[model samples]
Target: MSAPTPSARVTLAELAAEAGVSLSTISKVLNGRTDVSRTTRAKVEVLLDEHGYQRRGTRTPKSRLLELVFHELESAWALEIIRGVENVASENGLSVVLTESGTRHAPGPEWVEGVIARQPAGVVLVFADLPQDCRRQLESRSIPFAIIDPAGDPAPDVPSVGSANWAGGMMATRHLIDLGHTRIAAITGPADVMCSLARIDGYRTALNAAGLPFDRQLIRYGNFHVDGGRDNALELLRQPNRPTAIFAGSDIQALGVLDAARQLGISVPGDLSIVGYDDLQVARWSSPALTTVHQPLIEMAEEAARMVLMLREGEEPNNLRLDLATSLVVRQSTGPAPDAVRPLAAVG
Candidate 1:
């Protein structure tokens, strides 16, 4: 069957009649209410889509609130993000509404329903991608959204803010190489994560550019946490020909590496050098200040908030994807390689 013309105006009553449902049922389906039966809701939604139905006059008024959603609040950077979002929200006389939604991939349906009901000014989601259904619901109501993706992976069509993860990795490895460390190892986040792959690629590239050998055995992947760092560092440090320097994926992981070095009676920057990612507060507070990559978490959050606000104002973003630069922060955690250490077996 041919689809209805875009210029044709379709009313809620017409949609209800076409679906053989009550007008309230149509409204419930539109609002994402769970009370309506799936079959009925599906019928109404198909009709709505066919007719290009848009609730022009009935659009919910935007509230004086901005929604900042995270899959979880446990990360060290969560506070930084919150501070940045609040900075923008307060300046614009909008209160920030924080929500911890579903998995890292997307927010749950319940969160979507709450957002549709509240009709916030805009939303900033810390996720890899926004689910299509959620995006449609938000867009249908004229609610704008942006993704703050630290994972170095985002949907191309979506407006997103992320950091230069590959560059950060390259900087960390290059620093160690410049310090005359030939036997270096790296522990990054999960192998499946795009950021992890980008970082490891950076590490390999730096090694290649410096005429150093890339040893697969010297690379490890784990969660971006203290335990992942500690466990992986212990294994790498326990080897007879252990690396003289280690580059960690996250600041939290670097702490774990420090603990491992201490347990093995290895001196920081004396017998072993360490570099970490994310210049978090704890990085400076450690026994030996951590040498790390400075990811602009707060600035990234601010940029995402601004982008959403721009969209709310019916303005298009200059760029759908923005990757902020990363810089290396030198600290006491890294130093030249020890005299006794040498490059891996393949490199003499």
Candidate 2:
């Protein structure tokens, strides 16, 4: 008997015909579209596996293009993260697509839908909250996705990468405490964000550990922007029982706090000490360099991108909760408490 020749590449039409389904139904099942029954999807998936068919444009049977979604392109923080993602994707010979969530006023929902239509290998969400419906759609389709600094409710089992925000918060507050500052205030990011909440918990933990009472009056809410930081700082400074030190959740907010102090004619470390999180380039170049807890943003981005690629290749990534450590960098912005008052008695 003659040896049988292998069939050519399996087409969508062939898979549908073999499965005794319509082409459109097969397409929906293969691409993870809605309105498909679980039984039908399983059957189609099995057929694809049996035939050794490859997705279009993929070099290897498992290779794929990944998409990165960001809300704003102008933010240096976001840009650095994107660079990290690109570096990892390039090194692995994978393709990447970039999409912006549109402007602050008019966030474009269409872009997300468009990415889903294109069916990239996976997705990486940066600093933006994704809708529940979108998440559900992706889950139904079996598209792998990961989030970096996610601000929304994350799905269980989905991988995520972020710095140790709570630890960073604790480090920042502890740095202030070590500088002999007992009356320390905190400026936090949006209340809904997990990072903000984690940082707040850290701040409270540090204060409690030092035998200090957790004073709610010393905490202020900000939008993680410079203007918000400035406003919060001004409000804190106007209070009768003002804090001797301030910890801003982000570098931008720290800058705002510094500006507010300058406007009020208060000398940094002479009368007020300030600490910031996220040691972006601006933190070091400020008039008095910011003492901050540095979160490895680039490394975080790289890890997130790498994980997405691994998922695309059908590899189970060993790392699930990749928690990066944070360290405090002392600088001119912090010093011993001002000579204006005596230290409070330790609680314990």
Q: Write one digit per residue (lDDT tens) for candidate 1, span 222-270.
A: 9999999999998998787899999999999999999998877788989
RMSD from true fold, candidate 1: 4.0
For model 2, the local distance difference test gives: 0.77
Q: Residue 346's C-alpha lDDT in candidate 1?
A: 29
RMSD in angstroms, all models?
4.0, 8.5
Candidate 2 colliding pairs: none
Clashing residue pairs for model 1: none
82-194 in candidate 2: lDDT tens per residue? 88888888887768888888653223657655665677778887744445445555544456777776334454455778778889889899888888889999999888777
Error of 1 at 221 (Å): 0.6
Q: After superposing candidate 1 on the true structure, give the runs of residues whose Cα lies further than 4 Å from its correct spot.
A: 1-14, 22-25, 28-62, 342-348
For model 2, the stretches where C-alpha displacement exceeds 4 angstroms are: 1-21, 24-64, 102-109, 116-119, 127-133, 136-142, 150-153, 341-348
